[model samples]
Target: MMPAEDLDAEYPEDDWLSLSGIQHFSFCKRQWALIHVEQLWDENYLTAAGHIEHQRVDDYSESELRGDVLSIRGMRVFSRHLGITGICDVVEFHRSSRGISIQGREGLWEVFPIEYKHGTAKTIDADRLQLCAEAMCLEEMMVCSIPEAALFYHKTRRREVVELDDSLRDTVRADFQQMHQLLSRGSTPSAKPSKACDACSLRNLCLPELMNKKSVSNYIEMRLHEFVTDD
Candidate 1:
């Protein structure tokens, strides 16, 4: 395993990956590479709606203190060990008997990161893994133990708590390693069509049907012929 401090020396600052892409990469490697690697993106209803929701959360001007809890919005976070950087929607520092002390603050405070999502909780752990990644970054930056975090879903308007367990942390680290390897190779993997493709914004550009066909070359040739004949 690569040590945390050695990451900056190993990887250049320009090569740092976006922490949000972990969820995309976890969903589909091809999608991740298409967006982050090839720089292709198309916003469908879901993604556009998601952007709007995130904008609302990010537009808050200043941190607010609600009694013992200090709610900080749009908190920037990065982990050199993971080679990823991104912003959290909100991170609430709650006063606790056994917690880390903040500068100029009288009481000890426990950090709790909250991720805002446009959709409801999924059966899979994609959202959970993303939240776990954020929590890991927080732990690395603050040098404290963050045992859990929360995910706020727009559809449900509720927060789902996620425990930062060993297994989840292991998964986050392993996924980031895989992402680094994929980015280094700079080769987008072939499309693997599934029911999930229907929901993907890049389905049209990916051309799953044509790519999955037995004769991809023939399909391209036929399309070219049609274009030429039409002109």
Candidate 2:
């Protein structure tokens, strides 16, 4: 088992990964590499809507105190051990007995990261892993233990709490290591079509249908032969 402190050690900034890509990596490794490694992106309706929603949350310029909870919007976070960096939508510092002390703060506060999603919760653990990654980063930064965090879904208008357990953390560590390896190789994985592909923003670019076909050249040759035979 990798020690928590070992994951906190800093790496070169140039090689830092995006914490947001955790969901993409969990959903599909090829999709993550295509966007993060190859620098390719195609925004569809769902993605466009999600971007807008996040923009609204990120645009807030100030943090505020609401009763015992101090809400910080658009918090920038990074973890050297994970070699990932990204912005959190909202991080609430709630007053608690078993919390860490903040500089110049009056009371002990526990950190709670809240992530915004444009859709309802899915059976897959992509969003949960993403939220857990943020909590991990916060844990490293603030030197506090965050047992759980919440995910707010726009479609459902509900917040779901996720517990950051040992199994989840181990999966996150392994996924990030695989992601780094994939980056080093600098090669996109072959397209493997699944039910999830239909909702992917890169469907057209991925060409899942053609992926199963013999070859692009063969497809073109067959089409040309049919055209010639008709004439």
Specify the highest-lDDT model's number: 2
Residue 34 in model 2: lDDT: 89
**How accurate locally, in lDDT, is each candidate?**
0.88, 0.90
lDDT of 1 by residue, 1-231 (tens): 345654454355677899999989888889999998888999899999999988888755877999999998998999887889999999999999878988888989999999999989998788898999999899989999999999999889899999899888888887888788888888788898888999999998887776656687787999999999999
Residue 37 local lDDT, model 1: 82
Per-model TM against the reference: 0.88, 0.89
Root-mean-square deviation per candidate: 5.8, 4.7
Model 1, stretches more than 4 Å misplaced?
1-10, 60-62, 216-231
Model 1 error, position 23 (Å): 0.9
Could you give me the TM-score of model 2 versus the true structure?
0.89
Clashing pairs in 2: 7-81
Best-matching candidate per TM-score: 2
What TM-score quantifies how close candidate 1 is to the native fold? 0.88
Question: What are the per-model numbers of colliding residue pairs?
Answer: 0, 1
